[model samples]
Target: MTPRTPLAAAHAAPLDLGGRTALVTGAAGGIGRACALRLAAAGAKVRAVDRDREGLEALAGQTDGVEPYVLDLTDLDAAEAAAAGADVLVNNAGIQLVRPIEEFPPDVFHTVLTVMLEAPFRLIRGALPHMYEQGWGRIVNVSSVHGLRASAYKSAYVAAKHGLEGLSKTAALEGAPHGVTSNCVNPAYVRTPLVEKQIADQAATHGIPEERVVSEVLLRDSALKRLIEPAEVAEAVAYLCTAQASFMTGTSLSLDGGWTAH
Candidate 1:
């Protein structure tokens, strides 16, 4: 009789993804870029999608397994098609408009929901067939603390994230029977280009200086006073894709520095 390899030995360390394919939206920068690099390091071939051509070029240059796919996720058909054949999906693309609902433009709000909420639905629709056939898949939605809690002057952003949280939970319930898992990593104020822009916009809207925006507004509810690094959020995302996390579906991993504790 042939001896079987130990399960622990096969699982190993650093969470291997040798032949898997990972699709990451908004991969040109911030949490998306960090997730792409981290997954690539775990041996997955990463499809790095974003609208920024130059940023995609730079991202492709930094890694061997990353294939940059420049795309505006508002093109829903194209976004769905881009997700085909992925063993893992990270829905991280998002947009922000900082204005009170009464003052918010209907067009911008529509665009935000289109990109953040609708696109993920289509991508999942496209990816599910393959995942179900293979009987294995991972979906990680890079949601925000705003998904679980509301914030002022971010009506569209907050609404979109809240919708995503619901979508993620629904996916988890349906995908469980097919050996797939869906979850959200909810982080607060990661040090990303998106957050940098938000700081400036918040400052302008609140009549506060940019420096004060971080401590006075953003970190006002948190037990920790610093902005989370993109890598830290990416690590949480990577963990969701690991074998150890196979049972962790339909849940939100809060990396909010204890903001929700309030």
Candidate 2:
């Protein structure tokens, strides 16, 4: 075989996150939980925040360096408070409500937006001063493929994700000179509890079988013909936190399995 590329050789070495403190929102389940676990395994002290107290505690119990915090992201003050003392912030909390725009409840719309967009912005704003003082920081916003494109029946989620992309870009610009970077990981459908629920709901609504929903409703939109894994997204987040990624900011790394290729 040909010799490995220089970049590939560098990537083969393990990332060192020792002594770093990271705050991961929505760390109770799915992608968030995976990210928290991966960070802890890489030697980071992680503050795992989520609305599910038991779930957060369970995750903390399993991970050596994880500290669980039960908090709602819709409350900006609480989110900001949870973010204090973190060198890295992973804004991964979000909700998805599937309904037509006309049928979508106003309260649900506001709640999703508040959690996905507003809370990430507030957390970044609150965390930046401390990061600036340290002259180093990383903000990883877990956006979605929906952020880059649109789909039917996901009005609120898509809108909130789109707005989050913009906010991350703005934050990246402001943090550039201070050795801080802000970037987003936009992934397509991942096989998570959230997606499982979506599959069930879609099955019920569309009068299709649960098995068919994954292939027909979810992956049908993607060119890769596969759903992404939570670990895949978590790996991308971890890569962005490294020293090599210092020059990267205000950009999105899409893990969409070619969903947006169309």
Winning candidate number (lDDT): 1
How well is each residue in 94-126 modelled by candidate 2, as lDDT tens digits? 888788888899999999999999999889888
Candidate 1 on 92-156: residue-level lDDT in tens? 99899799889999999999999999999999988999999999999999999999999999999
Off by over 4 Å in 2: 1-13
lDDT of 2 at 157: 93
Kindly give the stretch of ten consecutive residues in candidate 2 with the minimal lDDT sum: 4-13
Give the distance in Å from residue 61's predicted Cα in candidate 2 to where it truly belongs: 1.4
Q: Residue 180 CA error for candidate 2 (Å)?
A: 0.6
TM-score of each: 0.96, 0.93
Model 1 whole-model lDDT (C-alpha atoms): 0.95
Worst ten-residue run, lDDT, model 1?
A: 4-13
